[model samples]
Target chain A: MEKLKYALFTGCTAKQSTPEQMMSTMAVANKLGIELVELTEASCCGASHLQDYDDFLSLVLNARNIAYAEKHGLTMVTICNTCQLNTAMTKHRLDNNEELKAKVNEKLAEVGLEYKGTSPVTHFLYAIIDDFGLDKLKEMVVTPLSQFNIAPFYGCHNIRPSELQNETHKSAENPYNPTSLDDLIIACGGMNVDYDEKNKCCGFHAELQSPHTAAALTGNAIAGAMDNNADWMVTPCPLCHLKLDTQADHASEAIGREVELPVLHMQQMVGLALGCTPAELGLKHHVTKVDFV
Target chain B: MSTEHKITTQNVNFKVFRFNADEDYLPYYEDYNMEVTSEEVVLDILNRIKWDHDGSFSYRRSCRHGICGACAIKVNGRSTLACKESMNDMIDLFGNELTIEPLSKKRAIKDMIIDKADFWDKHAAVQPYLVAEIDEAPTSENLVSPEEENALDDADLCIQCGACHYACPAVEHNEDFFGPAAFAAAYRFSADVRDHSETRLADVNEEKQGVWDCVKCFECAEACPKEINPIGKITKLHQMAFQEGIAKNNVAVRHAVGFKKSIVKNGVLDEGGLVLYSEGPAIVKHIPVALKMFSKGKIVPPWGITKSENLDEIKKLVKSSSTAKF
Candidate 1:
């Protein structure tokens, strides 16, 4: 709470492509007096890619990411859902097993790194919700979003498997019943409307192999949100952002309708509340319009 | 004794997935608005549609309660049992408009009915029944201790509802993946203390069609109607498989383990080394996919030659970890 400092582990998806997510996350965190230290030289969290090869290697890759945070003596905060899940699972695995920790430490030792097992992988959504309390967040809101009926899309990985639940997250709540993003929406004076497919997958991961199937999946979510008359939608995952925003053209084609629905990242939504302009929040760089935000 | 207000419905509508194998047409959504029932289940609304709206509208439902798991369908794209989910809860979350479909990852036979053959097949492959682990039969009724029962208590609640199977991304992509319900069912018997695990463990290690295929999406655990936590069962299966030494040189394991090795050696994924090491002979078959990824700029060059900043640390991390070299 006291000027929280976290090594921001902007995973490959956000770091390479979705700079707005990282930039706005930093901007919002800084506004709350939190320092966003960069977690660098870390490998990918192995989302679905590394998991295919070896489960142990996925843990190692995750551990290496956490190790970067540990090296700097800080907690690792991330905006990517897959990265958060992979890192949190690795942390849970290593935390419970001393033997595995020693083994991982031994491998880490060769590269002059040691898995001290200190840092925790925190998703930026929970990071903001927990550290920057809803009360404080509401106080910081310069622009109220009551006019926009926003749907909070809490994609798949960031909220479940129980093992990833930390101090800020609770698996006790139904995974299908996502209300975390609603807090942010309400904090910014937005109507956090319910859409049928609020918890449905964006099919981003599905897109790489089968574009058609992925498009259909994204189209379904967009249609669901539109059916509920949502002015716009906000999501925590950058992958979901890509599917909801960039692929709307294809999604529209798949569903046989004009799916020109706008999507914004959680941070970008927060940036709007804190009166950050389009350029400041990297809204101009997005595939979608800044009509709502 | 109590001054209470009357329960009422506010223009509730049902969007049921309508399909008829007898009819030569694609599936479509047929909407029906129902009159007052304050505490009605989705099944009740479907029954209303059958009785009042149209007699031809067909669906399956054995129990009005949640036990039978017969009314499993996609309520707003999530596999849910209509009998179990309440209208009040639905209204609270998603308002009066409900979109129902025969569960995804399945074939809709008619209306909300889906072909359960593959589900039953996968469930059966896990060998859901149980017998003594050893050859000798128990002299009396094989009674499990309270603690043991407590360990497997959650598993007992499984109603064989294929909700998790439909909810799983793994099952959507890979038809043969044992799936969430099957894994949970398998775990129930495996943890029974009386069931032989050798065959069951072998079943779990099936190429990519088993536990390895699960991307840990956790949608299974989320969509589970009975709070069975099927994802937990799959994780338990992973541990048990490791313990049994029931291993295979599969794509998932090879990719997962080798990805770490590549990162430890090079800062990031050793692209060339990964395909050569993990895929081995199968690398040639995947060249087109790799080229597509390459053109998209997803995979960059310098291959495995790129060195990371913390070379020493990556090496120690890889070398020190207790990884099984298959």
Candidate 2:
């Protein structure tokens, strides 16, 4: 198979807060023969934080970020669901409107940025599944994580609004119940389970806004996992992992139940699949102990 | 499962958020395995849970159909109109499992019953009723042109459902930001041709507490059962505010400009530069914050500018825009 290569867009959460995920991803990518060209100069994807403030401003901000990838002849692959969707939505907006495209190109010209819109924003989940097929993934898993009952958390911003996703992925993953992570988990020799809380927001973004509400929503997910007896909760977005992992103890109290569930990112799981021990996967940093790993 | 998948069972599990009438304790989830079918709507399941499983379970509903918008409960994290949403639709989207909770962004009273008091207050904050600019009362029945009526059609569909309000991140994050449903209501009056007081009504969005505060996540649009696109309307309100010169501050525009300039100059966002540009002299107030973040290692020094040769292309892109200046 041809080598898989793309520009890796690691937004704020991953870059500043959780760099271990990036390291684990690099480790996993090397094992899978995928090339990640880090866009070190790239800015924030103008997530809802910026976009909602001003539509046109965000459109151009994301447009410039995409232009960097286009300049290098690569599609933008983002780890954070928010960044992925933001860049995807910006591309979607640019693709349909010629006037916006022309104007955005002009703004890019000011600082030597121009986008042909050839580059598509892809979530890293799809990067592993659709880009590097699960069959290829299975061949690489040194250790099969068998019987590891995992509940897949597909964060809200990741899959819905089908227009933002690739047609192939849009068909492969349902917005209501996305299975890319599940399929990946299964490929790594893990069993994906069905639970009431399998697909929902971890309310990670809301912690700064409404701490109680965020805790309650996250608690709901843990409570659902408790009811279903999930050994671990795995998610793609770092923000979701942050809330689900760090907030589990507090989440348990808020939901008025005894609950504790460790959370893991896809790459860390990938690292484990490649035979990296829990210590190697940076599992020690996780607030909830994954002693089983 | 494909979209055709349906849950065919008499005892469908319902995990709902429950609180007591006494307001005595933290909220909890109570599972009720209801004798319901795939043909039933969520409202039917909820009614059955209240009537058969536990009579103490309190929820508000009137006009059992979609009109009243009283039974707006969150079905699996989405603020959905319980009366209209079908179980099969949910099954196709999600699986056979159903998790119900009280409307987000509000206080919970009892099982599936949220305090709509704050919701109604925000609704009233927008002055939902219309006021005609004409001083003289029309002798004949008030008539509106087709074009004007067409403009109102989208906003007219709001059933006073607080679904959008519950789904809005702005409402959840900023206490002051007028939410989607209220903004949609504000747009309805502002867009009305007969409403002469639109200029003053539009002034409501002039501050940080208004339309500009929205994070534009589009959750409201996703949650709205009527497909009102309240966030879309909120954007239109921003445009109106811009046009009417009600938006006095240059914060959003400055942020937008700063965001682009940093990209063009550095091929990345200059957080320091962005702060200077977006906040202007107000940057002094945030020096402590910058220091705090720096001590935390969150603030990484810029890697310095890359090749400026591509920057000309970015400049050309900036100059090509209709309004934005680099």
Candidate 3:
């Protein structure tokens, strides 16, 4: 049993919007006997703006972060899918595009930074599943959440664009493709149900651009969970949590039902079943309240 | 279940992801070798499997008419509504060994239904509904002439199914990008004669998420279930936004504006000057980006390029084209 460690890249949301997920992830890592070193000086993963609005700006921004991680001699583990995609795409681009790399390296030299493109990035779930085997997870489960019927939401980044994580992880592209999240959930003594709309977007962009669409999309997930008689919904992405938990009021109105579905970050749920307290798992920050032991 | 429906049947194998109440949640695919008909939709097949074969195989489908967009799933590698896609299509393609799953880029809800409401926020953010200004009572249903009303008829048919958005290369890179549906819907409002174009453009231009993010991949056009050409609408909106000076944040706008300057001054696009002018001092940023290109000798200097001699004709074209709103 080899202990796994990660250069944890929590990004902005874990620091600002959904601190609970970060806490839960850390708790789960501890329970699984995994070591995590936080990247403290890491600034914003450039968020989603630079990629959409400015191409060159996005390249420079992501290049800086990748160079930082490479210098540290550790693979980066991102909590946010957007951050994962940006950093991963930058690494992909840097590896493929030599001229771009040289120019970026020239600028990096100005700032005392050089990107050698050595570090590989992984999502938190990848570390949990591949590094912390199912055997270890089953041992850590203190309470089986058998009373709960849950739907798993993959969001967008966990799957899709095999280029993000590389060809070896292409099997993860299909949302239906099984992952350790489901195994951990069921192992914790919780019931995992087949849900409709489990892979739908939470309208994270809608939060900034259009509240109505965000409400409708988030509402659809809530409604789908309610329809399936799910006590709560579980997702690995914190951005999805923000939209799913915060948009309950709007989702409730659209579905014409009290769709008060609480969304638990997968790490939070895993932590709870591992006998971690609500405070330890940071459950208080979630917009939807969860009854935890 | 409808009495008016005439059902037919065929033996097929469905590798369904099953969940056990007491057992561990291992998603083993069970081959429910069953019979299905040509007229029967995928949703119908699932209903049969749940009722007779497996009681716990849960999924979602409603309105069956394709209007609600609830039954979307992947039949082969392509996304389609379960209610709308006929089993005949599958029999024709993959035959009995059909691997049905929820849509890609979403969480699998169950057998074949995926949570597709994410596009709703994108639609709402783009302000999907019609917004018109009519102080006086319109004599006839907003009184749109056939020509003005039909201007964006191609853009109006988006069902918001989200296949195009998921398939797009640009959307994969840019999270803030509103993707095809938002821009298509934006054009829907922008093209309306009664809608306040200035106000609408203001809203469209306010964010990085608007039409500016489109890389003109045209993948959305291919994925559109409806005949609507979303890429065309995006192009139209780009022209409108550029001409109105509302599409200022767009990287493409830098190219457009610089090209306009070239046409006006040198009678055609001065290719070398165009890049320098469009990027300005920001061209310094390219030093880092172009290093690999420089190493490969692909980085061409932004100078000594021949300029277009048809600058006057291009200016005339821009001037003459300004009157017609795309």
Candidate 4:
């Protein structure tokens, strides 16, 4: 396996809501000798906001971020699936639309950046599998995570339309149902639980508009994980972690039982194995604390 | 953190999304605190809000057991039938401070009741009724196996409540997208083993508004109250589209075909090859409108075309999985 370095683009939500995921991801990257360069001046990928409110703004904001990555001579790696999707989707459009490229380049010029559409945007999970090689990952764990049974929730962003994700890099054959997370978790020393509904989304889009259904949807996954006796629900995306973990308290109240399962970003679990403390990774702020080793 | 096992039996707050089109202002929240028991469905809590707090608080609800699908509303943020979701789950997930609202991205009829007439009209466009080409009434009854019945059950349980249609991003962005609920209903009649209508697939394929428009978000499956897997139904419809050779006019079909071709060849999606083959020159006619998008930098050549080194292993897994299926 060869070593790789990347300019890490921690999108807006990771800095605030799910910083633990970013820190732990960097921690694991450091442990594996994968250089993750932080892009401090990097702005938001406009996340779901641009998608929901304004397409024009979403494209511009995403274009600017891509221009930032392109200038750095580094391919971008994103922790947020929405950020990854937005950047990839934006990049796809920018490469094809000459007029959009001209207009966005004008916008980028305002910020002293240009759009060439050369660099690729990917999630951290894909980088580990593609760059580090799974066999190498399988070799690095100091502490075995055998006691923990996990349900790996791949939110919408990492694996979607072929235009959005390089499916070869993604784990699932069927775009909707991918088994990559199971393999990744196993390599990291955790037991993967096969729940009938593992591939489903946490209804994050619905969370902004219709929250009850979002709660129920999140609740179902938490309950399903608990029913399968999963110790912690491991997810690759921050949006799923935020919606599922922050909303679990509400899900438990709705279901009339304490659905106390904590959801962790995949990197946090890896960081723990690399001998990093939970406090260092911002694990304490999570709605449910994962006490298991 | 307190490990207080005792459940708090308090009156929970509901910050409801209130709307009346006659008013100058758009719909906004109006709070109501209500008492709830362990078994109270969200419909019960809303009914209490309507009856006691404000008589003007109007919402539609029929079968309280989630069979009617009429009481669907956005609790917190996800779409759900108010009848199916209990109050306990609400508090645990979002805390006692809750926000109840009608489905966003839809024309609100009054309070939580949305004008589903457009949905029904599009549904009718798909011709949802059984199109069986049989003359016999019945010798006895059309009995289906449990496995067969289970396969079709998810699509059948949809009560036409438009939560799925409301929650879907594709349907919201593209009005042409047949919307999740309609696609599910299309699958329901299409998959029915009892209906041997040759025109079944053709009828669905004929509609400009069909399964081809779906972005495969799985929001419909997430919103379904009966645990009727709409996502699986949509995928099955995609499979049917390919098997029946009806993939000609579908956007989603191209993805499925491309996926099959990729797996058979490189064991993954080849964006360059897929775009060249799937939406080629004939699709070039649509490229003019797509160019406005291109001008916006919304389209590009996929970053890389190189195949993964483990393509053989992925091929083996696909082969082994399919053989296991057989």
Is model 1 an incorrect, acceptable, medium or high docking prediction?
acceptable
- Interface RMSD of every predicted model, in angstroms: 5.1, 5.5, 17.9, 17.5
DockQ list for all candidates: 0.23, 0.20, 0.01, 0.03
Q: In model 4, which runs have C-alpha deviations exceeding 4 angstroms?
A: A1-28, A31-293, B1-8, B23-25, B134-141, B249-252, B282-306, B310-326
Candidate 4 per-residue lDDT, tens place, B207-305, comes to 355555444455666666776666556656755765666556433344334444554455323434554555555565434434433342323344533
Q: Give all TM-scores, in the order shown.
A: 0.68, 0.72, 0.57, 0.53
Better of 1 and 2 by DockQ: 1
Tens digits of lDDT, candidate 2, B1-326: 56786667655677877887587557778888766677889888888887888888888889878989999988767678888998877766666567888886247767777777766877787778777656486788688889998886498789987888877655664566678888888889888887767454554565545666555445676778888888778767765665565555556545644555665565445656766776788677556535544543434555732333344544554445424322
Model 1, span A1-293: residue lDDT tens: 47788998877655434667877887788777888887667776776555444566567767777888998999889888877877887888788899988877666666666777788778888878766678988988898887899988888777675435643363233565667898889999999978767876777754533455567778888889888889889999987887787777778887789876788899999988888887778776566666754
Which 10 consecutive positions of candidate 1 chain B have the poorest summed lDDT? B296-305
Output the worst ten-in-a-row residue range by lDDT, candidate 4 chain B. B317-326
> Which candidate wins on TM-score?
2
TM-score of chain A of 1: 0.94
The whole-model lDDT of each prediction reads 0.74, 0.71, 0.64, 0.67
Consecutive 10-residue window with the lowest summed lDDT within model 3 chain A: A162-171
